[model samples]
Target: VEPKITLTDKELQAEISELCKYAALLDDSQLEVQVKDGVAVLNGRVASSYQKSYADLLAYRAGAKEVDSRGINVHWRHTNPLLRAQRYEKVTDEDIQAAIQRAFKHDPRLLSFEPQVKVEHGVVTLTGDVGHLTAQQAAEQDALHTIGVQRVKNNLRVRWPDEPASDEQIADYTRAAMTRDPYVERHNLNIECENAHVSLYGVVDTQFEKYHAEWIASRQKGVVHVNDYLAVRTKWKPKSDAAIEADLKDKLAYAFVDPDNQVTAKVENGVAILQGTVDTWYMWQTALDQAIAAGAREPHCLIEVRYGLPSGPHYYGPHDYVPR
Candidate 1:
């Protein structure tokens, strides 16, 4: 085996600075980076707390032992350099319904089953039979993320196969699957099963891990329902509501070519609430993701997606679906 080559502090700093310069969410012109003894110090004015945390992640990825970001200040008064041009167009219930139908037809998981999708005033109702619990949830998410969808009513039933495994077998399978999942750490994780109902009790490091654990259980052989009691225990100190809100705003601003004043965010008792109108489903999802990155718990999204008349060529075709 070749000898391991460790990057020096100078090399790490240079690499991190280059990474920042190319980072779409960061304004490297405003940043000053220094590294000494494997510790990276960042001094800059960024628009959001999410951006600051992103820098920390980059430093760690570039072999830095620690990162000090106290010198970074949040500046939200400026517009985002990458903001997309605002569009004023109309989206009807018919458009929403049609989009969902196309999505269902294109989805590899939904290909065999034709889930009935109805849209009334932007609210989508899904009714059909899916082969698995994950398929049902995936259908709901597809509708929820679609443009012009205000709400999703998932009435789809999971039609489990006739051959069923025992509860003990299911529990064992779920545990084994979770252990194989790179994102899920089995430490303190408890999996219980009763008549096909799976309950997860554990402490996870992030919200994604908790959700992933539930998903892993739901895909097991005999699982009919998943009761996730997993709690997220963040490693970092909790931030105030004001800080989280500021971070969310900055993150949204960075996502667009212009500061999207139409979007507004607030945090109430650690729950981030996003209320806004965006021209596309992408922007709407970006707002919610930013809220999560800002350290909010179960961020509520009330954003509206208004499909605009295409200024350029736009397609509604689907890409290859990867279930994982």
Candidate 2:
């Protein structure tokens, strides 16, 4: 078990700032941190919402009980112009590829696997074999979230070590895992396994729980793929479509400093549909997150990315990146 972090507020503020500085994506963010009690507040401008997420993660790692990152703004054009050209410090495809390899080395799930990496422009491709499905997914996530990476092509194959477990054994193990997990244990989930493919069928309270169930199912040995069919149960009373849309718009405006209101939210039959254009994947993701927080369960995002660079081929869809 990891030791409990008990840093003082002042020390935690410094620690978070230092940690942010060490991250490649946050190097140019110039973020400022303020800590009071156990809450850490971050204020600065970041190029992408991914960088803001990384900064928040660092704050929590530095012992902050609650992270207030709303003060930090996401500017699609926040990078230093000189650093991209005159300073000769722009991140290259080779740099991104190397960073991903280092990330894999640091990741406990990927330390034992050496997946082949190839980069072109800002796109990365991972092609190799891993002993489990989790490692394969981790490889893709690491590459996809890396700074300067626009998209990831995960062609990595998952090959189980030794003999693959029988479908019955796989289901038993997955069901046991769900029982052991605190998030989905009491949710009365149903699991089925066929040819090493795990299927999760149940209702979770939130998207986090739904994803957590799928995550646990995928970790089982001999599991090749997880088909997540878990539905999110709406705990709150149903609201009218207009009410939901109004709530979504209010949440988005509060979450972002979008003067032009690049993203729009609409509701149809109690479901929220987000439509608009944003400059980067992070903005698009933040819109979805805000929609869910505004009581739009399983919202459909129809937002388009307006980044100048050409997007990678649609591996899962037409979007630049798929939210895990």
Candidate 3:
């Protein structure tokens, strides 16, 4: 058994050395290939974002039945070199699902969204509207990353494709972004050019409004970056609301006619005092009107007139009022 295993290791190594040379020939693909038995793994990097997808194609064509591709992709800003790679001995169904789920998670645009993808016999079938054309393509490319995936059938639709758009088509992909999006209008969100960069300065009330405005600016082609400084806040509160309470003492001081009735009228940041009022219905009206007209923001006042009525305290609702 030991001798057989030794021969197997030697065979796997030789296969890898030969495949590595072939992988180097692909366009802009810097992949370092390794093989163990019939399985293969590709390491290193590619320049285009599409390198990962293209590299996987080469692996299968080289007669690899199973693949391990964890280190096949690395971002442009990545500094780490590929340490090592080897073909996985066993490929499970969970491996494919894990790879698919990974594609959705790591890709920034796909994380909070869903796409109808059907994986069967290592072939991925994609259907449904994925917000935009680019996301649909990204999902397909991601499916191709899995070890056993044979092919991808892109049945996905972009809800809108005819309208002229402004996105750079590579950076944020705003044209493809606005199709299934609920906010953007076909012709309303105008993107105009200014010195190679686009600036959006406008007012937006709803979240959809802000999203559409940003999308329109983002869609403008030749745009290196979008500079959006739009206003979204709105005034929904009153300018001033004053709650004032006053005792009968203040009202009595204001109305000079009522010396017996101590009355106080509360106004907006103002005070009305009435004194010497022996109450009648006619006198009450006369006293209230005087306080309102003389001092109040809106000619409105809350009047507390003490008629000096002789009565015992009764609890109508709240706390008892102690007579001073």
Candidate 4:
């Protein structure tokens, strides 16, 4: 057997301290780090959930074998001058409508559907017919991301062509689409179709695969709606919690653009709990994807966005955004 390499407590604490110094989300003055037998324990008060998570990730990356983050408390309000002065601006209804139209016009997936948008007191109502359910959902997502929009009412209808595909044909086409897509092809998925509505049942390794399967079904020739009942099943591997945490940290650190922004992750039984703050909403999403790709079955996100900054969280409506 090969000799096991381990970090001394002093070395581990020093490494974690250095990571926290570079993390944009963590408040070093309020944090206390401790390590024993390669396990790191973080004690501190963070302004947001994102900071709490970042602290955990920093410790793991610094060579801690296991992380205990129970000592970190998340305080919703921040005392930072920048965060305190952030104001919510009210956007006009006409602006919201214009933004929605622009979003639809720009996205090729939604260009075919000319959905009527109406906004009253920040609530947007979409009324139109589209060729596919995905298009209808895309329109709703556009409205939600518009500034000052509070809620969305998606009244859009999916109008199947006169020569709609049969249920059997729809199912077959959906399976073919999934198989063609390299990301979703390897998983064993069961597809069932009724009245052009597809239902998927299976176990995949990541959330990306689960949702990709649905997207494939929705884009099929005659799919009405996709019902996803898929589950995430991580392949069993003998990995220490510390090893998994370090791997996740490396992935996020390399991909993340903002050195100031910090994100932390904890793993238990294949589940990753992510917490911290990111500079932008796009970064927030990227972090989640990286975590899932690093073998996290289900990642619990407590990441917070510092609004009012140049790189802050963007508003997302009920339906998630679908890129063309």
Candidate 5:
């Protein structure tokens, strides 16, 4: 027998509130829901392209028997993606670094190798220069599982000194190593060699490249040491302002591929300037990449990520903050 008493308006509102609470927990902004005529209608925005999707995730979790989500807006940034990306590298180098540091401090066998981690906008870039691939991968996996990291960019490559090579072979090996760098390969950063050592006097926009170069130099067979003077140079190369403008426009597509973040770049004499509004740290990194890839020589990107708004002390300062 069906219950005789129908649920009151107040009861429905309370139930809706409870369900929305779960949505808040999921941090899913995919839909805004409404209950009317004993039916739940959902409307909002989602980033996935799948129409027949699991987006009813929160609705189902919250006990919606019949959910209508046709009104929800679908949004996606990349259409013709670079590849069928199984995943995008998202973990920051910092989160992984802290994880490794704490893990080793707690357990003894981890210190035989040097570990490098860089976190920029929640994405971690791992470059283990210990010359042991096994240890490098292990350290990277440790960082991937660390809290607060959304993705990982495995830039960890095997070093030369540990790869069985002579001192003379080391110089040629170092040059070869420098060329293999994605940033170097993509023509993102510039390199110059003096003696057996190489001076990577270039500006890199992302913190990933900043530390990546360091790791490469630290582990190269012949390199005694790399000069840290090669800061994250975001300066662009250009003779005329018009040339700078041209370069900036050309590079915009590389970094600002995501339509949501509106970013523009301009370069003059190797100094790159970026301006635009972005909602997150990931977008900020993209802007930096754009500046460097646009034929900038040691590009110095002075782009704003969050308008430099000061937050509460407890609030993390993104890249500046190292997790406890």
Candidate 6:
């Protein structure tokens, strides 16, 4: 049996305040923290959604039973020069195609498959068959990160070299893969296979684990498509909307390595709404993954990809590096 820990309300409040003061993302000078009956209420404004959410997590870590952050408002700042430059510079169709090819060449997973790329104005259409779903996603990401790409139409299909395995075989492979994956192995997931498609039905703590399960299943040798019906299991001791939102914001900020990416999250009635801009499709997907991890039941992702921009803090030539 686990031992129960207790703290007085005054002690809890002091600890929460100290935690907030030392938090790297939060501006302690602008915010105020109050505690009552182990619940912490945060007031004031933050520069980004990331900071607001991070502050809430600090409160929880400091032994607050609950956190309220509705008083905090998000005031975002526009700092990216590339976003400003887009209004003046016009990227041609040829440049978009070249950029897409460069992105494909840079990604080790997509290096083997030469998907045909076509560009019309700023719209890119990719049509080819890859070994698996991850490669197909990589191809679409290639188009999404290309400069001047206004939209991506990924018609890439999965084409495996080996003979199609039976549903039982696919299920076996999926189970083995899930067992091997560190993120997914801890959960008691239910796996179902039909034809080449696999379905996952289970409850996990975070959105990352839910998507990670799907990613693992999608990579199985015979998997053509994955149907994820996995749910995020709420903890026995539930957190307030403010706490969940704050947790989500920190998760998203950490999940996407690029500091320039501006993503924000809001939670209401267990639903999380995300809005902002990222440099690549991977980061966009990662933002959604973080939302799910934060225990949002229905995460509405409104994030957009601004391709052909630097993905990280440092320069890595002209093309964005493919996340391994």
Top candidate on TM-score is: 2
lDDT of 2 by residue, 192-273 (tens): 5666777665456789999888888888888889878666756656777787888888888776676554778788776677
lDDT, candidate 3, 1-324, per-residue tens: 111232343454444433332232232344666667756666776555555665565454334566677776657643223321222224344555555665564455565467676777767787876555446656787676555566889787544434533333332343345444655433222122333344443234456677556655443444434555433434333222233233232443555443555454444444333333344323444444443334322222223323311111221221111111
Q: Write the per-residue lDDT of candidate 6 for residues 178-228, one digit (tens) a residue.
A: 888888787655466666777775456678898889889888887888878
Instruction: Return the TM-score for candidate 4, rounded to 2 decimals.
Output: 0.48
Model 1 Cα lDDT, one tens digit per residue, 74-105? 76754344431111025568766765665564
Arranged by TM-score with the best first, the candidates are 2, 6, 4, 1, 5, 3
Q: Which stretches of candidate 6 lie over 4 Å from their true place?
A: 1-83, 87-89, 238-324
C-alpha root-mean-square deviation, candidate 1: 21.4
Error of 1 at 301 (Å): 36
Clashes (candidate 4) = 6
TM-score of each: 0.45, 0.54, 0.27, 0.48, 0.27, 0.49
lDDT of each: 0.68, 0.72, 0.46, 0.68, 0.50, 0.69
Query: Candidate 1: misplaced stretches above 4 Å?
Result: 1-89, 236-324
Error of 2 at 169 (Å): 1.3
Model 3: residue 312 alpha-carbon error in angstroms: 89
The whole-model C-alpha lDDT of candidate 3 against the native structure comes to 0.46
Report the error of model 3 at residue 163, Å.
Answer: 11
lDDT (10s digit) by residue, model 5, range 1-324: 322224453454345443332221222342456766445577666556452254454343334455687886676642323221211243234534554455433222235665666777667776656544345555665555454556778776555454455434544455467678776444333333344344443344567877776677656654544544344544444456566567668767655666766777665565666666665544555555555555555344444445322121222333221001
Residue 83 CA displacement from its true place in model 2, Å:
6.3
Worst 10 residues of 1 by lDDT: 315-324
